[model samples]
Target: MNKFNGNKFKMDYSQFKTEVSKRRRSAATRELTKIAYSTPHSVISLAEGMPNEETFPFTEISIKLNDGSDFVLEGNELAAALQYIPSQGFPPLLQVIREFQRKAHAPPLWDSREVLIVAGGQDGLSKALEAIIGPGDPILVQNPVYPGVNVVITPHNAELIPIEQDDYGVIPICLRKRLQEREASSLKMPKIMYINATGANPTGTVMPLERRKQIYRIACEYNFLILDDDPYHFMYFTDEAPRSFLSLDTEGRVIRLDSFSKVLSSGLRIGVITAASPLVASIELHMQSSHLHAPTLSQVILYKLLKIWGYDKMMEHFRRIRSFYKERRDLIVKVAEEHLLGIAEFSVPSAGFFLWIKVPGIEDTWKMVMQRGVTHGILVAPGAAFMADTSKPCNAIRASFAKASYKEMNVAIERLALLIKDELAKNRSILNGNT
Candidate 1:
């Protein structure tokens, strides 16, 4: 006979077990929700990879009716706030996206490629990945890539092969070598190659036109599909913005993902996928299965705004946002030169929101900084989160100039410099057996 303890209450523990099991398969993006909710302080969050909301052009936005009159919603944009529409999204919105793509990319008969609206660039990417990638298929991604892409690829049981990249974006020579090796081994060839050609995430590098052409040539030779994720295409502050792979893609092998989030409001969560008709159809089916479609109201509102303002006005707005971020980038670069250039190395980005800093000999920069620097109210994204394998050694950290004000940016950069100096001293002392 065994005596039972009263502390062990009689309950159906199996039911709780079942619920937990169901959640184990949930998407990794859902984990961010928990982190966002739990934090109390206003996180000077450069980690989200989101654009500055303050940059959106609200002043130029005005609604007009067909009856030769001005129209206004008391709630501002009710059409964007509340509505259920098409799975493919509003036709007018798709038409506007097509026109923008045509002028921006200068593709041959760019209108031939169809546009499908999605929840966000990530959503569009996930759907396209689902439609094309099967379990165990190889997906070639640049090393130290975007975390959102990692989230999508992991759950699909896809093999993520890391392609080496530099200041000019993915090195085509390295890519060709890797592809050839994989083919020689008789292993499955990569089904797709996902690239962020313009102002890449984590690493603020833009692929030059020559490099883009080289990569396109490799894709054609290898017979692998190209997923051109170009959210920051219009964010280039430099005079020479690189041509996209989609423009060079004669075989219709490139699927371009564009987002309004970078240049507009991220809260709207609007993105579009432009590709060949068959590929677009497959992506739409996946969208139908997942979300049915992007919000109808948001699409319509954007369409109306574009119709009234035109492309030139939109480009002007983009230039303003670009100037604002370019100043921030310059400020950060100045700080790094004064405080961290010798101790750390970084590339001066021509566009986009991030500054990728490399601190050699420190494998876990996040733990070192958070355990010490977070006490000073500074935060940064660890290099490991961007890598495919977190356990592997890495010496980089990603900082942003998008969200924080100039004053805050100055303070944060100073604090980061101090943290790096302290860590470096500690490492030196250990090497000398002084600690």
Candidate 2:
């Protein structure tokens, strides 16, 4: 466990920031809005173009829950929802998030760090990548990473340094080896490493605490950043949730992305970026030019819900969510084992709702999934979709039990088993020149 004493080991954010991020400044109207917001209510003199709340069509918004409870937004709440808010986020929601962060991760440098609300987790991750990566810049990434990360990196023309993973998640030895091998070459070394640490997409594996510590130590030694995009942190099936990279971050090198899509509502489009203040500022500046801010209405609704739930009730909601998903995970695992025991192999997912399956004797599962699985009345995500190099063959397939019913999952796995058998038979026929 490496420890840092105060600000002595603070990371130089400038070295990790890009040239474009350095040029970004707060928008003129936004800056003025900030000043106007800071002043007393009596000193408000109109300096920017903002609409009167009275002109809006709706005077109030009401949300009814499944338990026959209603949350009404009226008066000032409705007004705030309709109007533009700060780029960082609504203050009430920020306070709730700050409290949650304190109780949960308890980041060592809480005072020096800040949080920014983005449209969603993807938006936050994209903005963070945009803030740091330039064309041809080298970046370290888990080999079979979430394709969405690649989608953001590809547009920037980043040189992705792929590090392979075992069943346990990314291997620490592989990371050190890659860095060591790259040091002797002409390729530019990576300054950023992106990972979906908990309930990782596609693989559905949770990184162990010891491995996380090793990786964090490696980051401290090599002087780089870790993009810890963890949307399924609270959905763990284990007795205790795995610690996040942010928990181990004492040097302010981890930019953690958290989302409500998996738990609350995906349509709400709300996520947070917790990082050092300078990095948060850069992402906020980027947001000013892009989406400007997350939907004010979404922020207010979430704030109202959180305020009603409070810290204790919110924690209860997380526990319920975990149990709900855990049941589904168990059901799907049982069905998969019953149907795919000898034909395919998969590890029971520890956190997220996905199961990664690999079929023996199959070079690539893409054709079976995209081309034939549909005909069989079942569809699972092809492994190639999550790979860094899509051109290469991938024998794996990602199955999700999140939304499907037990009977539906059973049927889907049965169809998959048959499909694999058909592909295997066809391959054998070709080998014997009988086709």
Candidate 3:
């Protein structure tokens, strides 16, 4: 009987190098990849990374030219589309992204090879961290950060020192204190500062220009890198636009992560890293080794879209996306007002997909979310899940207005209100008993 097929092959299985065990791999991702590769055709698969082909914009793509001509790509064109391309990105799309980034953010120290297309914003962020931060290096972060940041820093055994944030996001004083504290304790200074400045995760607080200026100054003063993880950069619904760290950067210290996920399509898994060319080179090696490049087919698709739509038209498209999400945000806010106004105080998010609600009485929203999900089928993300300290008790929860229908949001908030009121009343009863 083989080890694999009832009759064992004579080949030595132990000859494989130990390097295979040393590479960083996600357990869930590995499982999914395994299932994707080995599953029989009869079994339906939800394990693969690729988005449903049907959900893509078109069955076939036709690009109309400016001069009443048309450029078309679909069957035959797709073969070359998947061919090996530069690890940085598709050549034409790289140029387009560079130009688009310039017109939009306009970082001062741009150069050739400064912008590289990554698989997604998370890829850009994790790879950037993995590239720079060696073992035990310290990195600065704003508290209640996007969890993806942790995935990067933890693997390197890097210390994540969180600076507490106010409603304005990343209080300058707190950041200064954290930096000074490291010095006071004789600890190594943090080499990088990772921030999700716009439409921040779970909190949705957008950093204003003044705060951006202060943070940029601190970065220059402290001589550290700034990892600007801004997936929600274009998702703002405010009257005036929120300024990005990239636009404020002067000393070439900012590595800006820009994503096409929120506005365009998450399925594309395309994002750009804008920085000085030298830093770009450092990060490029990571991509060169793993995944090699972003999906070539994705690059080709986006490039054609950009070519057809051009920059101005694409800006219009983004405006329309903003308008759509703005409408959704208004609907969610209206529902929240009706159900949760006084019970749990919350700021109306000017941009982004989430409303971060603070319930005054409750110590933590994690149990409440679970109870509601079990009893009433309403789900929300507990704010503590976003905290730097998982054990910390936070009185907040995040609700997204991204995918839920208006009626669903209304009902969900109503159920959530009931849960909060019940929790508050229960706490009061227990307190009275103790007294």
Number of the top-ranking candidate, with lDDT as the measure: 2
Q: Rate the local accuracy (lDDT) of all candidates.
A: 0.75, 0.87, 0.77
Between the candidate structures 1 and 2, which one is better when assessed by TM-score? Answer: 2
Off by over 4 Å in 2: 1-9
lDDT of each residue in 1-435, candidate 3, tens digit only: 101122122222122111222343334443344354345879886654555444445445665644475766765465446455656777778879989998888766455327889998888987877766767888888898888887767766778798888887889999998889889999988778889888888778888898899989998888887889888887887677888888887776778998888877799999899876656655665675688789988888889888888999888887888898889989888888889868988887867899989998899888888765558668888888888766789998989999998888888889889889988888899999953
Model 2 sits at a Cα RMSD from the real structure of 3.3
Candidate 3 lands at a TM-score of 0.82
Clashing pairs in 1: none
Better of 2 and 3 by TM-score: 2
Please give, for residues 25-61, the per-residue lDDT of candidate 1 as tens digits.
3223323322443457676544433344344344234
Q: Which residue pairs clash in candidate 3?
A: 1-6, 1-7, 2-6, 2-7, 2-8
Going through the candidates in the order shown, the clash numbers are 0, 0, 5
